[model samples]
Target: MNKALLMCLLILPGHAIALVIDSSKPIEISANMVVIDERKNISTYIGKASITQGSLILNAEIIQLFSNQQSVIKIIAKGTHKQLAHYQQNQPNQSRFIEARALNITYLIEQELVHLKGKAHLVQGFDSFSGGTLDYDIKNDKIITSMSKDGTQRVRFKIKL
Candidate 1:
């Protein structure tokens, strides 16, 4: 993703093996249009919304950022018309780029958890996982995936030895 549109919440990508976020670093955002509702405590970026923080990048049709007085709290991103929202990172310490895609992606900043839903797919180096919903808990380095309620979906995993 290009420079994103909101400054507070920084979203990331990949493995159940947590990727660290340098929270001290500044956040940059760029989008076609951005809206900030100070009263509602929300910032919305529409049309080609992109977010960047250090080496991390996230792109979506719309990105909704929520914040409190002290810090950014949450980030919600959505793809357009059944497309996939995406995120990627390739820092020097990393062996390769880690990427994720989903129709909807949400990050809970304080908890350091990411929830990917609607055709979720995540790849860390050569390892990968795909499912209807994926929950990545950064702190504990755990991933939980599940099928859709209708049971019409399935989860897949490809882990490298």
Candidate 2:
């Protein structure tokens, strides 16, 4: 769908406070197809869905947004194993960016948390982390990872000094 129309559907009231880091920035989104279910307060984007706001960008095969009348509640992105969903954002006061990939990514807007599952990997500047699951607390600037349920995959981290 066109970015302008998509922005209208997803725009929050100017007076309402957004949960994202860059709340004041304008958001732009594009996709091959979009389905909005007003009854359920959900909007689903199919095909190559991409959402961008300032330096933050997210892309996936499908992206779903759950929202209320005032603001977005959550966002979910899904991608196949071969092409994992991607999320990236520039860090404040830093030239480097944080990039992440996973088969499924869920962003809890109000909680300021991002959950990544299945082949989850994240990189911030020169540091990298990979695990079966990754939970990022955006407000706290912290990450927690867990091993795969089968216990075959362990969390790994690489730090460059």
For 11-62, candidate 2 gives per-residue lDDT tens digits of: 4433222334565677777889888777787788889999887677889999
Top model number, TM-score:
2
| lDDT of every predicted structure (CA atoms) | 0.73, 0.81
lDDT of 1 by residue, 112-158 (tens): 77899988888877889889898876556577898876777699999
Query: Whose lDDT is greatest here?
Result: 2
What's model 2's lDDT at 63? 92
Candidate 2 versus truth, CA RMSD in Å, comes to 2.9
- TM-score for all models, in order of appearance: 0.80, 0.87
Write down the worst ten-residue block by lDDT for model 1. 10-19
User: Clashes per prediction?
Assistant: 7, 0
* Pairs of colliding residues, candidate 1: 3-30, 4-29, 4-30, 4-50, 4-51, 5-29, 5-30
